[model samples]
Target: MSPAFRLGGLELQRFARARLTRAALVAVVLIPLLYSGLYLWSFWNPQGNIGNIPVALVVLDDGDLGRELADNLIDRQIFAWKETDPADAEKGVQEGTYYGSLTIPADFTANLKSPSKDGPPQPAYLQVHVDQGKSYLFETIAKAVFAEVQATVGKSAISDYLDRIFVSFGKLHDSTLKAARGADQLADGAGDARSGAGRLQDGLGTARQGTAKLSDGLRTAGTGASTLAQGLGSAKKGADDLLSGAYKLHRGAGTLTQGLVTAKDGTSKLAAGAVKLDQGAAKLAAGNAEAFQQVDRFRPVINQLADQAVPFLRSHTGDIRQLAEFVNVAASFLADCLADLPARIQADRVKADKAYKALKTYLDTHPDLDPQLRTLLEAAEKAAKRLAELADWLDALVGEHLADLKQLERDALGVARLARQLANLAPRLAGLIDQARDKFNELDNGLAKLADGAAKLHQGTGEAVKGATKLDAGMTKLVDGASKLDTGLGALVAGANKLDIGLGKLTGGANKLNAGLGQLGQGAGSLDSG
Candidate 1:
């Protein structure tokens, strides 16, 4: 330290003796102070001077969000923010007119609005264009400023999106409350409906029971209708037989009337013959008396005459007896014919009337009977009435004339007995002959009256045949109608069975619907609680 100090003093004595060297030493010392002071002065308020840094702001977005971001950067004086297009901002950064440029893309606002929850998030970008070739500090400062701008945009966009999300949550909460209230009401309605469905199912069960009874009743009615149809068929057969009998009776009455007419003519001729015989008998008796008085003169002649006359008288008496027997037989035949004819007709009339009444009653009970069937019934009724009237007429006629027919038979027998007595007694012959002639005339009158009555009866019987024929056709139609009614009842029973089956299926569906509604109500209750 002593030698070094002695050498530094010699150098300082030399620098003191030279003016140039002294001046050089002072300059070197001042150069360090000046350089240090200038450096310190340059870095003193760099942050404060940040506003002087030229930067470009390019807002290409179509929405207000981009413009609002640009305006905020300018107001904050974070950089020398300039409103410019993308080309101008790029040109300014390259020409050193701007340190860097910040660009908001055309889709910035749109991209920010598209949340990740909606779909894939599209990130909004703020692009920074800096010229690091011009100055590294400028690139660094631009990057820092862009970072701040990014944070401001993120904060604003995120806050707005979060506000929107909160509002949506509020709306969702209100909608959930309304839905819960509606679900509660629906549950109540479903409960009421379930009860109603139960009641409906019970009612349907009752209806099914009633329908079963109805079907059974219809089946019973169908059986009864079948029986009725069978009865009608039998009735038709009876009617056909009645018509046949009426035709036969009509033909028989016509034959009997003609026979009575022939007998009446024969009786008149026999009466004339009997009168002539009586006159002859009186003459012969008178002649015999005279002959006896002259017997002595003409005894041989008297004997010859007496033998011929006796033979002739015997032959005439035999012929007269045969004629009287014929008259008695004819009267008996007439009496037998009238005896039961009225009774038979009366019985048939009653039967026909009964059948007609039954048809009418059936028609009255069944108002919906086919029109054609009704017409047939009406025709049958008319025919029955005609038959009844004819029966009544015959009954009245027989009642009025039956006694006269019996008296005619007795008188004919009496005439036959008188004729037999006349053959033995010639003296009584004339008186008996007069009585026989008178009886024959009375018998002839009775036979003529009977023939007239017989003609009327034949006419009445012909009409009865027509009426009976009509009744037969009508009964056949009635049988067919009854069969149709039975068939219709069977169809109705089948339809009722189908309806009962349908109701059972409907009840099952209602039960399923009630269970589904119960599940829906429970789910809604959980949602409301949440």
Candidate 2:
């Protein structure tokens, strides 16, 4: 250290003794300081001077997108933006009046819009026209600035397109939610429909059973009606026979009445002869004892004839009384038949009508019934209508003849009383010939009235036979119709079951659709949020 210190002090003394050396040393130090300071000052804050650089802006676009970009660049003041035409901008750049020219083409907005359309995408450009011969540094700076402008325009266009896409996603999310709600309602409705279809199937099954039973009952009723018709026919024949017998009895009673009147006249003549004979007997009492004995012998023979006649008249009276009683019974039966037949027929008619209505309702509701079934239902309805008409006819017949039937009953009772009076007088006919004649005349009148009543009863019975036959036929048709209804109901129930199954499947599908739509809505909501 001591030797270095000594050498440095000797150099300093030599420097102080020479003016040229001192001046050269000072100049060397100042030259370095000046160069360093000048270089530092020139580079300091170069970005602040960028506003002094001239840049030409040429906007030839037909839309506002290009103008918007130009306005943004001007407001930023990244460079001294000069608004000019395409020709002027080009001339300014070549003459170094502008560091560079930024040109927005006529198709700039069109190209930006193209990206949002449904065709091939196009790229939007910000054209940079720079002159390297004017100044390399300026050209470089202009290119860099134009590159930033391109980024700014690209970001603006991209951001606008992205914003529109996000808005569309938001709308889609709302629409999807509405669709999902609708699908849920549809699913619920399908489920309810499926349940209703099941209930319908059950109800159809019940109807089928009821119809089957009804068919069986109708068949049984048809058979019973046929039997009843046969009985009515036989009753009608009996009534006709009774009418013929009553006519014969009326003629016989008239003949008997005339004979009794002649007998009564002879009895009166005999009584007068007896009176004259009594006067002659007083005169010849003493001398004619032999004549008396002859009279006594003829009296016994007359008495024997009276005895025989009395017994015969009594037997005939008993036969006539029995015939009158039979007539009374027939008349009473006819009155009862007329009184009750109409109500019974009406009740049956009502039943038939009800059955027809039920079947018709089912047929109308189920239009898709089998052809054969429909035909059967139509036949049943016709049969029911015919039955009702037959009932009306029978009821009217009985009602029209009701008074006649009651009169016949009264006439039959009168004939029975006449026969009873004749029977009481038969034992005393010889003593009471006049009274017996009167009774015979009354019996003849009663018999004639009974014969007229018999004729009416016979006619009414014939009508009953015809009505019974029609009822039998109508019941047979009803039975057939009921069978057809049962079959149709079976088919309907089967179809209902199928419908229920189909509705179940539809419900499942609707539920799945609702669930999928819910997921889609959720995804759309997420996209919109992003």
Candidate 3:
């Protein structure tokens, strides 16, 4: 410490004596201080230096999209913006009047607005012209800032395009939901139609079976009527023979009475003639009694038919009528639905086609779209076209089948009417048979009285002749009643024949209804799947 202090004092005394050395040391110290002070003064407020970094902003876009990008760069305040045309900006950058220039192209908006899915998107670039001869800090800062601005602008444009596309997608989703709801409604309607058709088919099946039974019963009744008519004809002929025999007997009685007064020798011949006439009357009475018994046998058959027919009508007719009414109502509803289906389908087809066409136009205009997005759009367009075709086909199918449903409804009403007629006919036939039985019993009693009177002719031959006259009148009345019965049976047979034909038509209509329902089910399924 002592040696170092002695050296420092000797050096200071030497430096103080020498003016050139002292001047040189003072100059050295002052030069460093002046240099450091000048640097500190120049760089003290670095933020204020931004105004000195002059940069040219050249906007060449035709629209606001480019102008917006230029404005954003200017507002960042990283550089001083110089108002310049494209040519002036290029010249300023090269001549060192501007550190750098950013020029936006004329087609910037058009390029930035386009979105593509098949390949890389077409990019709109911000042209950066930097003066390489300018200060390193100015050139580097301008480049870095412009690069960031370009990236930000590009991102903003892409975000805007993506937002617009997503809006269109949202609208498409809403339309798809509407279409789906329509399909669900159609499916519900079809399901209801299928259920109604199934019920109608079952009702028709029962009616068809009932009609077949009725036909068989009518045929049996026709056969029985024919048999009864033949028996009545035979009885009428027998009555004519009896009446003729009775007239002959009356003449014989007169002859016998006249002979009793004229000659006693003619008494044996008259008595023999009276006895023979009485024996013939007895034979006639026995034949008439057998014919009456045969006619009476039809009464139980008619009663049984009435019993069967009446209850069948009462139990089944109400149900049949109700089923027919239900079928008619269902058919009317189906007709209404089908009537509008073609028009609705046509409208749907038009909408689908319009949407598909729009998508196709967008795809045509945007060739450089992303591949995945392009594929999705293409698929959507194709699906829309297919839906249009399916809707058209469904429309045509409804138009073709509506008539069959109407016919089915008409046939159901006809069956209901026939059932009512059959109910009325049953009671009327039963009454007619009862009347015939009563008439035959009266004829049998008249024949018995004639036989009794003929046996007592020996006591009163004139009374026997009077009874024969009354018996002939009764035979005439019986023949007339039998002819009326034949007429009624012929009318019944004709009515049955008409009913058979109507039932056949009804069966055909039921089959058509089933077929039409099947077609409707298929159309509903197609709509749902699409």
Candidate 4:
């Protein structure tokens, strides 16, 4: 302790001896207090330093928004705001009277509120002019306060923009919702329209098929009409020929009637003369020979007439049979054509209706089809309906003609049977005529033999009387045969006249049928075109 004390005392005395060292030590101790006091004296409280900053406010903007910002900056007490004009504010900053100056542009509010995504490039700013002559701390603090106020105004402007944007977005949302609803309605309408269009298309398809069928029917009808026209023409010509033949037959019948009367008179005279021959033997031989010659000559004429009549009847029978067969075949074909037409039309209509329903359902689900397409679809629907109607009408027409066709078929069958019977009887009638001719020849030969017997038996009167009686019986038979021939000829002429009248009616009916077919064809063509 003694040694340390002695060293400490010596060090103290040495420190005291060096005045400059002693002064330096005292200065070091006091300098800290001075520095602390100087700094602390200027800032007695933290709150006092806030408004102590001298800042100039150059209110260049005359609007309320800028004026409000100025008031807010001053109210914050961050700076000692000195309201001044722009010239004074700039002079104050340059003269170091202000730490910084804030200048608000005249169009501050307008600039602040103008919103752009790219940039509010020339944004409403607090134009700050900092005094370089001020302390770095003062300048830094002033600039920081200015930056905070600028940010505050910027935040306010951005907030206002955001509020307006939100409001606009709200209105847009309502408008968009309404537009969406309208679009939905439009889509629904379009769907309905598309469905209609599909239905129309299906109808059109059905119509097309119907028209095609109608066209085919028209063609067949036309062909049938043409054939009928030809048949009518042929029938007319045949009727004319028949009428002429009937007239000729009537004339021939009249001639045959006169000849029959003459033959009958001659036969009666021969019979009387034969009776007289019994009384006069020489006269009986002459009369028997003359009667034989007359009989032989009449036989040849009868054979010729029979041959002609048989051939003519056969030819007419064949023609009638052919006509009947043709009519029967054609009627059957026509019946087949009409039989299924109504069913086919109904089936097609059902298919078209089904297609329309399916298409309508599809369109209901998807309503965004083009408007022009919808219109076309509607038109198609109408066309299909019309086609269906046309088909129905055509079916009705066919039905109307069906009964007539059936009647025709019945008539044809009758004609065919009648023709067949006539055809069969024609040959037999000719054979009967040949038998009659042979009988006549035998009679002639017997008369000649009797005449020879009469001449030889001039002395035997009883045998001559028997021969005369046989000759008189033969003459009576000849008169009866001639009368029958005249009656048959008259009947033939009457039958021919009836046939001509029937053929004339048939031709007229055929002409009417042809006209009806033509009209039907025209209607079919019109329907097809439509």
Pairs that clash in candidate 4: 191-363, 191-367, 195-360, 199-356, 200-381
Of 1 and 3, which scores higher on TM-score?
Answer: 1
Error of 3 at 110 (Å): 3.3
Q: What pairs collide in candidate 3?
A: 116-368, 116-369, 116-370, 117-369, 117-370, 117-371, 118-369, 118-370, 118-371
Q: Pick the candidate with the highest TM-score.
A: 4
**Residue 121 lDDT in candidate 2:** 32
Better of 2 and 3 by TM-score: 2
Indicate the worst ten consecutive residues by lDDT in candidate 1. Answer: 164-173
Alpha carbon lDDT of each predicted model: 0.55, 0.56, 0.55, 0.59
lDDT tens string, model 4, 424-496? 5554655565677678778878887987887776646646566666765775676566556645654664455
lDDT string for model 1 (8-90, tens) is 77866865676644554555455445544544554466467777888888888877777777776777776778888866875
Clashes of each: 0, 0, 9, 5
Q: What order do you get sorting by TM-score, best first?
A: 4, 1, 2, 3
* True-vs-predicted CA distance for residue 252, candidate 3, Å: 99
Tens digit of lDDT per residue, candidate 2, span 283-307?
4443344444444455545556666
lDDT score, candidate 3, position 500: 29
Candidates, ranked, lDDT: 4, 2, 3, 1
* TM-score between model 4 and native: 0.26
